[model samples]
Target: MVIGILKMDICLPHLHSLKDKRKVLKSLMAKLRQKFNISVAETGGQNKWQRSSISVVLTCNDSGFAHQVLEGVVREVENTIEGFLVKYEIEII
Candidate 1:
């Protein structure tokens, strides 16, 4: 099996509170999970209102497919999310 991990550091310039952060993160996570059929969560920066770190995990039989899915996830997030994607990394193992 192949395991792919995608980690994203994002900056939410418009968010003013934890409530706003949670709302945006929840929607983003839910959308990613449903669309990619993978696991998504806030892995860091939980206490900060304007910064977030999100991790997405995918398990599959093909590494190429996993990488492709991760790339698609990144594109979707960058296009649709309210925050700026500061950086991202993808690892396959």
Candidate 2:
């Protein structure tokens, strides 16, 4: 099995508090989970109001497919999310 992981750092410039952060993050997480069938969560920057780190994991039979899926997910996040991307990394194991 091929395991793909994606880590994203994002900035919510318009957010005012943790509550707003949760709202935005929860919506993005739900969209990604529903659309990609991947496991995702907030992995870092939990106490910060404007910054967040999120992780997504997937299992596939081939490495190329795994990479492709995560790449697509990144684009989806960049396009659909209310916040802006700070940085991202991808790994296959």
Candidate 3:
């Protein structure tokens, strides 16, 4: 099996509270899981209300498929989140 992991740093411009941050993060995570069949969560920057770093893990039988799926998920995230900027890195193991 091939495992693909992607770590993304997302910046939310107008998030004011932890509740709002959690709600946005939850919605983004749900969308990622539903659309790409991947597991995503906030791996870092959780204590702050404006910035979040989310990590996504995708497993598949083929490395190529895993990469494709990760790429698709990244694109989906970029398209779905408004005024959100992301810096991401992907690794296959």
Candidate 4:
């Protein structure tokens, strides 16, 4: 099996407080889950209001397919978010 993992550092510029951040993250996460089959979560950056670290993970039987899925998912996430993105990294194991 091939495992794909994606880590994204995101910035929510419109958020003024932790509550706003939670709203944005929860909404985005719901949309992501509706569109993809992977598991998603806020894995880091808990204390920062504007910054969030998200992780997505999934497993597939083929490496090429897994890579493609990860790429597509990452792209979708980047395009869907209203805020700026700091960085993103993907790994296949």
Candidate 5:
């Protein structure tokens, strides 16, 4: 099995409250889980509204699939989040 992990740092420009931040994060997480069949969550920067970090993990029989899925998830994050800027790192094991 191949495990692909992606760590992403996302910046939300207008986030003010934890509730609002969580709502947005949850929506994005749900979408990623449902669409990519992967596990994703907020791994860091939970308190701050303008900055957040998410880690996404995908396990599959093929490495190529993992890579493809990671790419798709990154694209989706970019498309789904408004005024979102992201820095990401990906690893396969």
Candidate 6:
């Protein structure tokens, strides 16, 4: 099996408090999980209101497929997220 992992750093310029951050993160996480059928979580920058890091993980029988899925996920995030995606990294194992 091939495991694909994607880590994304995001900047929420409109958020003014942690509550707003949680709301945005929760909605984003739920949408990502439901749409991609992948595991998603807040992996870093939890205490900051304007910045956050999320990790997406998926497993597939083929490495090429795994890479494609990760790429698709990245595209989806870039298009749908309410904030700016600062950077991202993908790994396959």
Best TM-score among the predictions, by candidate number: 1
lDDT per residue for candidate 5 within 1-93, as digits (tens), equals 999999999988888888889999999999989998899989999989778999999889999888988999999999999757568998999
> Considering summed lDDT, which 10 consecutive residues are worst modelled in model 3?
77-86
* Residue-wise C-alpha lDDT for candidate 6, range 22-77, written one tens digit per residue: 99899988988998899999999999999999999999899999899889988988
What is the per-residue lDDT of model 2 for residues 1-93, given as tens digits with 9 covering 90 to 100?
999999999998899999999999999999999999999999999999999999999998999999999999999999987779999999999
Question: How high is the lDDT of residue 21 in model 4?
Answer: 91
Q: What value of lDDT does candidate 2 attain over all alpha carbons?
A: 0.95
Worst 10-residue lDDT window, candidate 1: 75-84
The best candidate in terms of lDDT: 1
State each candidate's clash count. 0, 0, 0, 0, 0, 0
Model 2 misses residue 17 by how many Å?
Answer: 0.6
lDDT for position 6 in model 2: 98
lDDT of predicted model 5? 0.90
Q: Measured by TM-score, how close is model 1 to the native structure?
A: 0.98
- lDDT tens readout by residue for model 1, 1-93: 999999999999999999999999999889999999999999999999999999999999999999999999999999988878999999999
Candidates in order, TM-scores: namely 0.98, 0.97, 0.93, 0.93, 0.95, 0.95
Show where candidate 1 strays beyond 4 Å.
none
lDDT of each: 0.96, 0.95, 0.88, 0.88, 0.90, 0.92
